[model samples]
Target: MYKPRINNKFHKHQIMMEDPCLAEFIPETRLFTNNNLIDLLNKYKKVIVKPSRGSLGKGIVVITELGTEEYELLQLNKQKHINGLENVYKYLKKLENFNIPNIVQYYIPLAKVYDRPMDLRYIAQRTEQDWTITGKYARVAKVGYALTNFEHGSSILTVEDALKSSTIKNFNIKELNEKLNMVTLSITTCLSRYFPNHKIWGCDLCVDEKGSIWIIEVNSSPQIKGFLELESLLPMYQSIVGYKTLNKKKGRRSR
Candidate 1:
């Protein structure tokens, strides 16, 4: 059996930064280190440290500035309060497995619904001629959880429903929807330029309270069933089949 994948955060970030359009949306990310952590904390005041190759939001740490010489670190459902930068670095190092490389990302204050952080997932797939967005939905984190992943008990919401339920005031629904579509397509196009073999992607994105959008990650071989049901995915299924059929025909003609 053959497999295709891109799980390295550094490699993916480097590829994305090459596209000028995407570089702005991606938050500052760096390899985890004692100095990097302290410097990032002093600059952004809050940063997230996570393993480079991890899924379902595992082993992620959210560090926040509490006050002078005091910081709070949140992992999964637990929070640890520590004082001073040296202590913070030592604590994180002891908790992490040194064998696995880790990355630190600027934590975006994502929009929320009912006080719980929420994000969106957009699916794009290759059509006969080009790529098109299939569908999108909002994922709200369970109360007190740090991640909005399905495995973490997140609740799925329609775009309209999420806006309606949120405390955000004076928001333009149409404008938000248009922005999401444009960004999702742009991301699909840019990534496809480098990795042409993959035809489908599950893009994890988020919007801040100021309506600024960010591309959190792009998942190849995403878990489609999270939002796509058997009936809803028929068109996508057909599109993939059509693409493969054309490729097979072309291969035979060349031989």
Candidate 2:
């Protein structure tokens, strides 16, 4: 039975990095240190600084290199243009949530639809037997915003619509689903070995313009409200509800 949700992003990243199959899907991530922040930025040019235990996109800052000695530190839609490394640290430390433990990661250049970035939420759940890919949807960022969580959504589209309309011009939908399913299952199975009680994960993932899939993060306690919004997912939502019930009943008997 699910006991408590896992909310530490860095810890989860370390756990998943142990599996060879899941490593490539994960972006370069590390605990936020002044050195790590600078190193990742220098290597990736564009990096994301986020709270280790944040959600709904709060406390996430996307830093992009605009030119020599010029950087853009974006939080929500407000962009702060800066001119030096000293000022970069100053600007970030001024944010209200600056004290929270944070992580720095190489930001994946996600595929965009209509000039707004988008990513897919892949949900996998388990039963008495094995994990299954149960729900998926494309979350488009609000125009001019960097974060695309439900709180910052422009609209939710079927994965098909997102892939075809976005900059990715070529894909066989059958082949794409197969790859997504295989990767998602591998992730859930690998995670289950460490977090035995968790039975569901909502992973935020994206495909770059080059068509490589990257796992943004794995959510241990994924919500179903977004799945409820899509009519086609009603049955899947019901099954999730049923699974939670079964877990609760089984937990009672064990206790």
Candidate 3:
């Protein structure tokens, strides 16, 4: 009888940051502060503001460059102008009051499907030898929506369907799967070195216009309820519990 384990996103992030394989994919995330926000805006004319530990794509803002002296903020499906540099600071301060950790990210203009932003959720599991990809779902941001999360009204589509509609269609299905698996494997291998006991992860990936994959975010304790129909889903569920049971038995033996 195996019991599953839950992973904490913050703890995993701290561990992943130390991993050589994942270090490059990890962004230079900083705690949200008026000064930091201003610095980010100055460095990149366009940046993304998002909750550090948020799920389902809630509380995301995309600030874009209007001109050398002007900028626009797209927050929660609404766009507004930041009158001046000082306003950027003020807006960040207001967000801080919510008592949530937020970070400024370099915006990656993700490729679109059906005129909506598209991203991939790579579900992975650890086996006796290595981490293996169990499933991959394509998430398409709803029309006019800022976030491409199912909870944000986005629709779920097969990766094949998504790639068909993408502007970059040079990649065949086999190539795409291989590319995704390689990236996910690299990231998990690195993260596991620091937290060897953990078992599951969901890597959020985006493809740019050039057909290159960029890691948007890494999620621990990924939601698997929606993937029950996937061929690997059952094995993943069993492996989770089986690993926990084996770990407990080993602890007892050591004692």
Candidate 4:
């Protein structure tokens, strides 16, 4: 049997983990299991367990420790407060209906806006010979949501607007953008080396209350309809078309 390369969350995470420097930006992630859930919840007090191959924030659950032997599970946009570690596992299993491949990551207290969570999405695409960042925007999660997925009622905001309203103290927009770009590019470069055929990436990142940046996820197939609505993104669309044209030309020459 021949298997195709799938860009699942765990696979991409492993690829990034190969590099020590890049690994630092990644949160502590592991295969979601009964034991893993108990340990991570106790460690992080607030951990996120999401589908390994799911998108649009579907099937994502947020688990928070209320106290010893007590926890709160957030899923399906609702909160269920439960007691005991074993009960947490049973509740999740019931909600899932069976075992599903998922990843459990230590939740970082991301910078917020007006008490709403938010994250930055870096749109990087490959040109003729190199990777370039074409767009950057912030997704302010809907009130009381754990994920900032655009499909889930999240609003798109300019990076400046997000930073201006950010809860991170002494936030520097200029410095943050610089660091974000550098890390986004680095991730694309590393992933490209492994999956050379893929050229576009949408990297989701966040800044903690302490001003430390963390990579939440790297989306290989990012939705662009929301971005296309902005007239300012015209140049980026052109660049993408240009890259397609250039690649076509090279393909002809090779033949």
User: Sorted on TM-score, highest at the top, how do the candidates line up?
Assistant: 2, 4, 1, 3
lDDT of each: 0.80, 0.84, 0.70, 0.81
- Tens digit of per-residue lDDT, candidate 3, span 1-255: 222223334445555566676666655555666677778778767788777666766677888778765788876567888777677667756763346667777787778988888888887776566676766777888788667877766767667777778876576667876877887898788777665766777888877777777777778767655444455445655655575576567668978
Which candidate has the highest lDDT of all? 2
lDDT of model number 2: 0.84
After the best TM-score superposition of candidate 1, give how far the Cα of residue 201 lies from its true spot, in angstroms: 1.3
lDDT of 1 by residue, 81-175 (tens): 99998998888888745458888889998889989998888888776658878667788989998788888888887767877777555768889
Q: What C-alpha RMSD separates each model from the true structure?
A: 4.3, 2.9, 5.4, 2.8
* Candidate 1: segments with Cα more than 4 A from true spot: 1-5, 96-98, 228-255
- What's the C-alpha lDDT at position 62 in model 2? 96
- Native-referenced Cα lDDT, model 3: 0.70
- Displacement of residue 42 (Cα, Å) in model 2 is 1.3
lDDT of 4 by residue, 118-169 (tens): 8988888877558888778788888878778889888777777888888988
Candidate 2 ranges with C-alpha deviation above 4 Å: 1-5
User: Which structure among the candidates has the greatest TM-score?
Assistant: 2
Which segments of model 4 are wrong by more than 4 Å?
Answer: 1-4, 97-99, 229-255
